[model samples]
Target: MSSILRRIFKGKDQQHQIVIIGLDSAGKTTIVNRLLRSEFIPTTRTLGVNYRTVKYRQIMFSLIDLGGQEIYRNLLWQPSLEKADAIVFVLDSADLRISEASKAFWESIQQNENAPVLFIANKIDLPGARTFDTIVQDLDLTRATRSSRPVGLFRISAKTGENFYDAFDWLADVVVGSESVFKCKLRTVILIDLDSHKIWTTKFSSLKNEILDEFNRSISETMHELMKEPAGMEVIIASDLQLVVVKNHPLVVGLIIGYSDSVVRSKLIAERLMNTASSSIEIGEFSSDVLTKLLKRQWPLDIYKSKPRSD
Candidate 1:
């Protein structure tokens, strides 16, 4: 099916809304950029909220990027809360003061009582950032546990694109079928589902051969083969395996591999892939468990079900 026809038939029933709120410069924009694998430069603070649509699996999401500054913080309540399927609160782990702010934000968000919240301790790459345990304790979030509404806390570095996928995968599970709230349009992009036995790329085109050849020579022969044929011309290498591609854009593809091999093997592959493509390559890591869930299209409801917030 053509991307256009798929949309025409699927209609708006296939979308959902996810809101990302945090203090100013808490790496909210960085998280979005990492997800899109593109840069979103913000010269000034977010005036109200910025919206972007991302497609994961066969589902599409209308992601609302809300400003975290004090002046704009109040705008995130009520009306916005009414439509949110999930909320991601990004925090600056390097700043102790931000921990207190995160507590306050959580308290405020708790009052809404409708949407689930994911606490993202962002900027883990900073030198002085507190560890995940420290941030959870400092924010007093351990005491704020709930048994009904699922609250998730993750430590991540948006700058280096670490743990961003884990966080999004959680949100994806929560809002999967409930994503119909988003009525916006989306562009044609392929979503790769990484699996243990094979790599699955979904879209409406025949780019699987291209992706397979690209994956084999640079990475592991263990990578085997591409499972499904490409739906669209777009191919996103989604796997827990490490992918080394020359340049950020898909057009500069060379080799994609896993990061688990011996140091010598990994370095040699990286060097070869880089030299072949002659462009900057990016290495992406995925949690094997998350990749499994993505392939099965199953929600990790167990993770969310354990802790519900108390009144």
Candidate 2:
């Protein structure tokens, strides 16, 4: 399915920036090398910052590895956080003092609260390394989640490459799809379940956010009226914007497109969304968070011409 989607949106490139920040000797450099270089290579402590770009799903993930020494943390953090789309905070699992110091750096941040943070309990290869659960408790992650940021924790070994792909997968998954690559007239993508009253959406305009809750309610009502057969569409087409819905049992996927968008393209995306929702890991009382992740997979980004990818 991914192969087919790649064929359709093959040329367009979306760029996202990610920065890695942690204390010195916490293996930030090791983690960076593990990702950019196919093989794990011995890494020296970074004096300042290291940068690399990787391509995935037509998006350029610009990774910045910032030096984590105390003297440089203040000077390095603000600028890096300001430009970051996501932040990876690495903690030295075997060193409690380093973990405490890293916490101080994280708490000092006053901006970019919306940027999702993926906390990596790194250096898990050590015999005395703290367990993931222990680190989570010590850091008070429960309190952190109640805050605005989208936070996640993972245990990783930069040396052995354990859970390496899983860690990167988490990063890419959290970084929202770029609007730069979307063709004009594509408005929004929404996912909902019939068995549960929950919805997730990625909208193209601010006006959509104002009307989304009410629009969603109307859609539910319209579905009951028009979907007598248990599977179909209920649309609202205005002069400027239009809506298209596709459904399979227990689930419905809708696309709010500008009237100018290609009918062929819109229909293809709707079908893709429906198929994915139907085959999703689970249904009934499904999570909007999980659905949001799935919805992004079907977003259409048309690559126009061959060139170097830039962020």
TM-score, per-candidate, Cα-based = 0.56, 0.52
TM-score of 1: 0.56
Residue 131 in model 1: shift from native, Å? 1.5
Steric clashes per prediction: 18, 2
Residues 25-46, model 2: lDDT tens digits:
8888888776555346888779
Q: Residue 282 of model 2: what lDDT?
A: 62
Location of the lowest summed lDDT over 10 successive residues in candidate 1: 181-190
Scored by lDDT, model 2 comes in at 0.65
Cα lDDT, model 1, residue 293: 41
lDDT of each: 0.53, 0.65
**Per-residue lDDT over 155-235 for candidate 1, one digit per residue giving the tens place of the 0 to 100 score:** 877765455555665666566535422211111111223322223232222334555455454434322222232211111
lDDT score at residue 246, model 1, on the 0-100 scale: 21
